[model samples]
Target: MKSSTLSTLLVAKAIFEKTKSLVNSGDKYSCTAGIILLQDFVELVVLAVLDELDAGDQKSLESKSFDELLGELKKLKVPVVKSGTIKALNKQRVISKHYGQLSEPASIINYFSTAIVFTDALLEHVIGSKLQEIFLTDILKDSPSKDFLKEAIDVAGNGGYLQALALLRKAFFLSYEREYCIYSFRQQESSNGFFGLLGMLGGGRKAYPWTRNKAWIEANVKAPADYIQVDHEKLKTDCMEWGVSTVDVENFRRLTPKVVETEKGVWHLDYDTNFAANELSLENFNYCLDVVLDFLLKKQAFDDGHKWPKRVKSGPTPMIYIDKPIFERPSTTSAIVEYVKEDYYYTVDRVVSGFDVNEEFLYAHLYPKDKEFSLTLEDHIWGYLLAE
Candidate 1:
């Protein structure tokens, strides 16, 4: 290899090493330092590429702000490398930098926690591959690393001070192996708690978290942080503002499934795993649940004076068991939760079979060839976490 080639690789190696060093410190200073370092490096390399293309006389790409430079690149008549992700990263930088007038401490940690992941991808760009292609689907779900997720959930947004109690509750149940690395979004005190930004997957070239709701709206001069403070009410208002409804039976049924009984017994009927896969994020779940609840509630399903009936039709209730264990921090015991939705609208915390409540049903009777563990369902969620 040429000496120049070796020199480039060494530069990349140094940058990569420095990035990890930034992550080693747990505070926000490290995060800010990491982002600044990576941002500067990306700028220099892209500018060098532009200079090599003999565009020097036309315009110095470095002179323009990040946004103008990116827009110019898109308009380039020549064969320029089209990259949405890189542009997205630059856009994120603008938001994080200009809007970060809030705090020194919180900004540092949030950026550091997020920039490390971006740095990894930037290094990949320093070579020539997109990072996502190399990883598995499951890897995408539980991303950035589990340790990161644990530390980040405690992350304060620009407005973290307002609602520290919400995150402190420790009462919420979350899918640890979720499809989002949500720390990329605006880290702030949220009304919906940790799950508020859950399924917001894409920001085009950048991960959705990095690109977030704007800090300000043009029309009314509302405080940017107010969006997080009243997300639930705002969301409801936004939906009503849109003023649209779905009249299709197929779409409605897809949202609200009928309970079916086969030889294997009862489960969510006509279940579309794909639908649940994406909607597992908090936003989507609440949206779907609301649509179903709206339809049923209008007919007085939950009301005591309903003409059709006060309760649901007779059906066999299933049990939820834990033949396997899924881990949670602080408490290593695996948790298995199973709850049944009864006849159209009525649902309960557990399966009620002829005046009896059963909680063991979601697990398999035998472990797979690669696995082995036995746990009772009662011992997991309520037993372990709730146990005094």
Candidate 2:
């Protein structure tokens, strides 16, 4: 088809998708808006068909009313199977938009299904394809998540919705798993008690038992550096923490077949006969699909560096996992420098480079103004350094 015609069809498909979502909302205003958009979607589909037939015809058809456009399609020998339903949708839209009337919530689902049937019939007649041919997954950013969703779409088309849900669950699981590689410096303090005795026994100060223990902790325990990884098993908790609705997630989980993880952490669908016997309808599949898509879209924005509003903490700033390092300097009254007791200092610039979070996260969660401190360093650069 012509590029212009193709673009119009895509837009019409998008409008239909939006209509589906809005009608499902069951709100008075949203249902009314859905009616209006659905009518526009039908008109646009008719316009696209005319454009594909002839550009001049499309220009002429654009000036005609939606009813006239549908009638013109009949004159041109194009399919008009659902013209009655399309006209009814237009009437509802007119009452809602011009008369300020709201569609009955009970009728919204019927209207939604009618639009679906009409669009499918129209698209099939004109382009030898159904409305489902338009893949919303195409609009997602190119990533493994998109690839998985595409696979899910293909399997869903073949009526393997259980398998499709498994793929979608995996996609969501991988998308929101946050892992950060953190590096830290250990606090060097004077040896005391048992450790102090060991220090004196180990060549009295030459071996430096405190430093030796520190090295041991850094080497054997791997304390100086580690990874902070969120648990994938806590899917619902993680979703809530990421700002997704618990209700939506619970609904999706209820509709989709159970996804279980093996001891090896490999995930797969459990095809128990009981679950397999449960009737999974297209509407159920669509609900789960929409939930996953909504989550991924929001996650994509966050991955693109969009900041979410900071949430308030209930109490004092929590201590981070990083170890504190002791800073020793010369004392005015003592012959030897004294070790300054403090938490490990963390510069925002330095920590941001190592952590997956941003400066906003540090300022809000880890190092709020009340918890922040400043200290002079050998480099003479002034920057707020935080501690755990």
Candidate 3:
């Protein structure tokens, strides 16, 4: 990342981490920096990531706060969009994960619409996997980031964008990306470390590629961020005690966003129309087999052909309820079948229980691993949500 691209004021992630410790433990300056630390991290990550995408794009990253960053990311070419993903938008994760505040219903909805799409793009480049195996939707279950995305989609797609944005304001007065960032990833666990230097990358390559190729050059990513965080003694002490485990000092990994296959009549299972996806046939597997006679009944779809949409139980207690299949592929993975959800994410490695989404997406981390923060499955779904 370029030094000229990021803001010095926003560059204090390490100091901010220290400030969070003080604030959490009742330090006077804690409250002031605590709330503001979120904004600082969001602002810096935006400036930093933008510079990484295109070095010359620094001016664009510097001038715009949150809105421009989304615009820049959205405008990326199809090549980058298809092969890449944009994570860390959850930079605003602090409010819920740190402050324990709930994001308003509407804010959660609107923010996610744009976010899911961006995350999808970034994941492709960074993880190099198909959408199905990426484990992104897995992360959404209890995650504030995932919740925000789903709620925003449900409200806006189900309601309207303006109303959703209004709800979004409850968390961020700006209701822009920066405010959202404050809610997601603002807390700094260390006074000095690689994450801090990433803060120092000041919008250069050091940070840019973090989103797409994070598995590639992570060792080099830490020094600057760590150096600065180490300078703050009190902040370091506070973080260690607050349940912000040492691993929290670096970054977290998450699943990529995906669009299910919805190609309207494009794909048809070799089963009977009596128990088809669009018909919502509540036929049991055996019943479906009976009517479909001699068919393999491998998959189903939506009227518009949304590949494996969520299966929500519809109608009354006595009604024959058919759910939208979470996945539209053969139960066994060894066979060569094109598990075509809307755009075709990677094939499932192993199905999670009987649920379609339980499968892991194909992800290969090319960047070097950072010693500071290593990602855990819990970070994505938060252990409790896994049960449901």
Q: Per-residue lDDT of 1-388 in model 2, one digit per residue for the tens?
A: 5687778977886677678668878798888888888888878887887787773655577688888887777777877776776788788889999999989866877877777677677777777655544434334687776777778878988998778877776666445422211111122234454444443332223222334344533554332112112233465565665666667766665566544322234454544466556745566666677677767765665567767866584344434343322222111221322222244333332222213232212221123333454331232222222333
| lDDT tens readout by residue for model 1, 1-388 | 2243334433543463465346445556565555555555455444433443444442555478765654554455422242444555555556556775222444444544443344334434443322222121112234233222223224422323212212211111021101211222344333132334332431111223223333322332243221122223433443344332333112333443223211222222233466545433433322333232232222222233436734566544433333323222223334433222121121123221211122222211222223223232222232211111
**Native-to-model Cα distance after best TM-score fit, residue 191 in candidate 2, in Å:** 27
Error of 1 at 102 (Å): 7.3
Candidate with best TM-score: 2
- Per-model TM against the reference: 0.23, 0.53, 0.21
TM-score-superior candidate, 1 or 2 = 2
The digit string of per-residue lDDT tens for model 3 on 40-61 reads: 5444544445554563445655
**Global lDDT of each model?**
0.34, 0.58, 0.31
Candidate 2 clashes between residue pairs 3 or more apart in a chain or in different chains: 187-325, 324-344
Off by over 4 Å in 2: 1-18, 25-30, 48-59, 72-81, 121-133, 177-250, 258-265, 270-279, 301-388
**lDDT of predicted model 1:** 0.34
Number of the top candidate by lDDT? Answer: 2
